[model samples]
Target: MANTPSAKKAARKIARRTLINKTRRSRVRTFLRKVEEAILSGDHEAARAAFKVAEPELARAAAKGVIHKNTASRKISRLSSRVKAVGAA
Candidate 1:
């Protein structure tokens, strides 16, 4: 339905961006899941290690606009707190 050449180009760009964003989102989710799995397994050290990896991924995703800054910060805060609790246990 994009009749104008500019509109067609914009559509193509959007499609490409969508794919890239989806890939980024999936990678972020995978990292988060790894952290959650480590936490659920009750291995504080493993969870900390996973969190160290995931934290940067989440921050990168937010910086790239794949997710909101506040959302990423909230997730990092909660995960860090939980990881600390695991260590205290």
Candidate 2:
């Protein structure tokens, strides 16, 4: 389909960007999952640590255009509240 040289090059660039974005998204998910797991296990300290790690990853992903800024902010706020609740308990 991409017969022209420019088109072909564009396709290749798209493929490379897709792979990089996928990796970044996956890394962000992994960090979030760690926080969730720690929260579920009721380990406040671990949850806090995971939140510390995940917050930056989420912010970076948003900054890089991998996700929306508000979405990232909402996630961080909710997770922080949950972590606080765990600590209070």
Candidate 3:
């Protein structure tokens, strides 16, 4: 239904952006999942390493507008705390 040239162009841009966002989101999830797996496996060092990698990916996704800044911060905080607990346990 985007008949006008400008609207058609906008639609195309949105489609492209949607794909990019989708990929970014998937990458973030994969990183987080790695951290989770490490934590669940009770490997404190591996959890720390995975968290190190995942934290930045979450922040990058937030910076790129795939997720909110607060959400990313919260996730990083919780993951770090859990990673610490894994070491303590």
User: RMSD to native for every prediction?
Assistant: 0.4, 0.7, 0.4
Question: Candidate 3 on 14-78: residue-level lDDT in tens?
Answer: 99999999999999999999999999999999999999999989999999999999999999999
lDDT (Cα atoms) of all candidates against the true structure: 0.97, 0.97, 0.97
- TM per candidate comes to 0.98, 0.96, 0.99
Model 2: per-residue Cα lDDT over 1-89, one tens digit each: 89999999999999999999999999999999999999999999999999999999999999999999999999999999999999999
Q: Please, what's the RMSD in Å of model 3?
A: 0.4
- Comparison by TM-score, 1 against 2, better one: 1
Displacement of the residue 3 alpha carbon in candidate 2, Å: 1.5
Ranking by TM-score: 3, 1, 2
Question: Where is model 1 more than 4 Å wrong at Cα?
Answer: none
lDDT of 1 by residue, 1-51 (tens): 999999999999999999999999999999999999999989999999999
State model 1's lDDT.
Answer: 0.97
